[model samples]
Target: VQISKKKFVADELTEDGYSGAEVRVTPTRMEIIMLATRTRAALGEKGRRIPEWTPVAQKRFGFPEGSLCAIALRYKLLRGLAVQRPCYGVLQFIMESGAKGCQVVRAKSMKFVDGLMIHVGDLVNYYVDTAVPHVLLPQGVLGIKVKTMLPWDPTGRTGPKKPLPDHLSIVKPKDEILPTTPILGQKGGKPEPPTMPHPVPTA
Candidate 1:
């Protein structure tokens, strides 16, 4: 099972409890790296549920049988949040989960705090983790955008050497609960500088 060539995909696929995936190849075999909100849900308990997607991927990508290995890593804030307090919960979760900083944005009528959640910007291509889940408000439907700076190393080798700005890092948030820290935005004031994580390998 020596591989002569390889292919890698980043953030191309996302599903419930699943955020993204990557493909890696070694001389011995191929590795399918799955990123999800819950490893158990994505890989199943003890991976007894791998058959659910393995065949699909193998056929879609044309990988040889028995040569592909599927594994999962966990991330958060992968899903959208509801309105009001749930938004606050997101902020708290990201910070508590080791994010350097975080922010939430919504319509002018639904202010989480006075100035914290007001500022806005074009985050369509921002590097950090973002979610634009829609909510049904009394007035109409509105979209809530969440952005956070996480301590993730995209390269997965020796972590990042320098500090990543709030816009460039990944983030995680737990169950919907009010977050204590003020939410920052694209045009918001600079947040406190984040401490660098120890240099180590990441998925």
Candidate 2:
């Protein structure tokens, strides 16, 4: 089978009681041209030179300094999405351990969308360190109960809600332990130490 810009052509092989036939599949003209153009552009010289840009030139090509250029290429080629604009705060956070980033930033915001399954009043759990019994709520910890699910906008006073800065405040659910019946000597009483048998009287 040969796939061309305009059509897919295949020569049928004779088997059983069937006659050999030629098969052809032609796509729409626009789609064919679009596919062909993309193919040539990708497989031609332009594709090879894309990776040769210097660090500075690469920045201009939509990659941040010290960031993964390969990720940008993959995003463009596979997802058909533009490279993410550099978040200097996030970049600094990556380079310097103590550096701080934006107040509200998600590691991978693109993967999640609005209208997730979590609903209001659902139970959620979060863990705390053994030493520290109190819970420590991070900026974006998962498994947090949804307090209030506001609409795109809370009130009509504000304009349309922006995509970023998700306005949900989450809380950890209270710990609930099932009550158990205590053993006769297990609680509020001491277990009797093993006692030696009194010496038996001589027969």
Candidate 3:
């Protein structure tokens, strides 16, 4: 079954008795496009639409027409609706390492939005790291909790809250321990790195 492609949809009601999303298809494969209601409102305020096709994704993944979706996922893990622009950050602390996992975040760069400057906290998001080749995180000594950008912005404030970030709820942490990595891949940093499938003792 296909998901609704209507704009400003709270949720698409799929037909029953059919297997819903049997697999966790990447953003490119599924005919269904999920969206956060908060993003829809934000885009709607600007007279934009949702459930649209991704132009770049189509070129990269080579999927069928109207099969892909350009969802406006909330930037909870990155920043609160800050300047509505992308910022660079690293994973200061990671929930799971060496695998497909959520990305706990800290802003490596800063920006101003709504007349205030936002900073980092116990917040995180999810991004597949292309460099390290594993689900990677920010590289630093501090740890913070961040959340996934939800369908709605409950707090309304752009700055990060003091509690654990929201994305953790989507991807739960394993009993496994994650290790620490220094800037530029330096080995002489932490005592032990538990993020890997096996632990390595530091010298």
Candidate 4:
């Protein structure tokens, strides 16, 4: 089960309207996952000293997790479908594997999610200057995800979304985009910035 398709960012139909969830354009460190191909990031300014990517749960639906694999060189989960969303802030994704090899993988959402965000599109501001973590690996510990959009939205509705730039898409991989920089250097080493639009998880 090798990664068949991947999308760093692309245009998508949000509840508010049409906007681009540019994962690369917006500056937010993220930890991406392969199971459902989800992207998540921190909320506070002083995020975390050591980011964690732990598997929460797993169940054999039909496919084999042993076959699911991440690209050794890439930093994002592979995707085979464009504009993919399972449910509830995107519970799963489609693998469009072919260019690299393979065809497709599982259907439902991932079994495990370590500190994955539930739906944080509004707070994903480029001007805010955030570091989103993304998981580059599949099974084992992967690289920090540099993403903008969060995966879980308890309400399943992205709060207030902004008009995406003419060239941002949540379905395409464009590492060319850069994250916004902090307001100032640690000259005085003051307190960290405030966390905007904090997402409250619903049990």
Candidate 5:
């Protein structure tokens, strides 16, 4: 993952909307997952860039030739997730893409959240590819936090044992209700308002 980031950033491809990357390494092979907003620019014409990138990845990581596999995918934006209503499809997508486990949480409330609600733990801090992107809403701007379990390997070089954490700190922003002050004459209120003195007492 570090090698991939360096390569993309050096080539100035990050300006082309390169979000980030992930790596799955095993005794036999290494998998490079590249995510970008502009896939066409990042991949070049007909994905010729992948071949160009593969050699460097293998050399930098000291992996054998042909043992390095590169894949490019479009990074999902917060706006896109919001349009999905609940984002269960997102969880399913990641799980299908070799992820050991995955979870998506929108800070805003929804009738049907295919994943979790408010969570509390240090689970998200370990072995998770956590992303909290913001989106605009009628109420206010909110964040959609995604925690994907890193791909695991038997070589023990992979991330923590529990990649898919069970808890998150994301929660919906509560509306603020200002405390109203009661009328001075009313009970449980402030002291009565001061009265003006009689006509300045002979002017």
Candidate 6:
């Protein structure tokens, strides 16, 4: 269950059709998950505060007037959940539990009552080497839970428990629709015109 980084040499193709040797680094499962969780946190902070009339806000939310309150609210909700810490904790726990290899699946959706919910599942396989007999254990699943503590409710009490809606159910990333799809067009409808691509610079 030793976690360490490794690098390997790989062939990469350039635009000029020249094949060259490249160092393709493959991070461990723990590193990958930690990086991803941190990225999520960083993106979640974009809308933490209301925007003013600025080019940054216009480019980010597409509305310099701060009319996109929904995005800001969603960001606030996600920040409260503190996804990065919990996700990393889960991975560390799995490695400590004798898992040699692990894969994490992340699910993010806004259909929950709390505005945003992130679910993580770790699929792990391990083997025990002992003098008695070497035994390979079957794949196991570990789930991570993220809870928020409200200032008003110090005891961390939750409201009535209700089943998650179908839309909120955890599903594979491939099966989910892009978040920007709705902004582009109606459901199942033709997407809006594509934005012009930036021209590549020439030497």
lDDT scores in order? 0.45, 0.28, 0.30, 0.26, 0.52, 0.29
Best candidate according to TM-score? 5
Where is model 2 more than 4 Å wrong at Cα?
1-39, 42-47, 54-56, 59-63, 68-203
Number of backbone-clashing residue pairs for each candidate, in the order shown: 3, 0, 23, 37, 0, 0
Local accuracy of candidate 6 as per-residue lDDT tens digits, 1-203: 11221111011112223323322222311211112223433233453222231234346333311122222222333445453543444344434533332222233331112222223322111111101111122333222222221111223232113322332555566676557633656776788787999999999
Q: Write the per-residue lDDT of candidate 5 for residues 27-111, one digit (tens) a residue.
A: 5334456678897887677555755765665576665321222121112331243445335555555555565565555555532
lDDT of 4 by residue, 1-203 (tens): 11111132111112223223322222322223322222222211221211111111113122112112222112223221221221111122211211111121122232222232233354444211112223324455433221223222235333223433342546776679665875553676776777899799999
Model 3: which ten-residue window has the lowest total lDDT?
126-135
Candidate 6: regions farther than 4 A off = 1-79, 108-203
Per-model TM-score versus the true fold: 0.30, 0.16, 0.16, 0.15, 0.34, 0.16
How far off is residue 57 in model 1, in Å? 17
What is candidate 3's lDDT per residue for 16-107, written digit by digit as tens?
Answer: 12223322345433333334434444334332332232444345455432122112222222223332232122221122212222233334
Clashing residue pairs in candidate 5 are none
Superposition TM-score, candidate 4 onto the true structure: 0.15
RMSD of each: 25.7, 24.8, 24.2, 27.9, 21.6, 29.4
Across 1-203, the per-residue lDDT of candidate 1 in tens digits comes to 22221222222223335566656555644455567776655545544455455556567667533122211111111223235445565456455655555566665455342212213454323324444444444566665555544443566432244443453644786779887977874468687677998899899
Cα lDDT over the full model 3: 0.30
Q: Look at candidate 1 and give me any clashing residue pairs.
A: 88-179, 89-177, 150-170
Question: What value does the lDDT take at residue 114 in candidate 6?
Answer: 27
How does residue 76 of candidate 6 score in lDDT?
Answer: 37
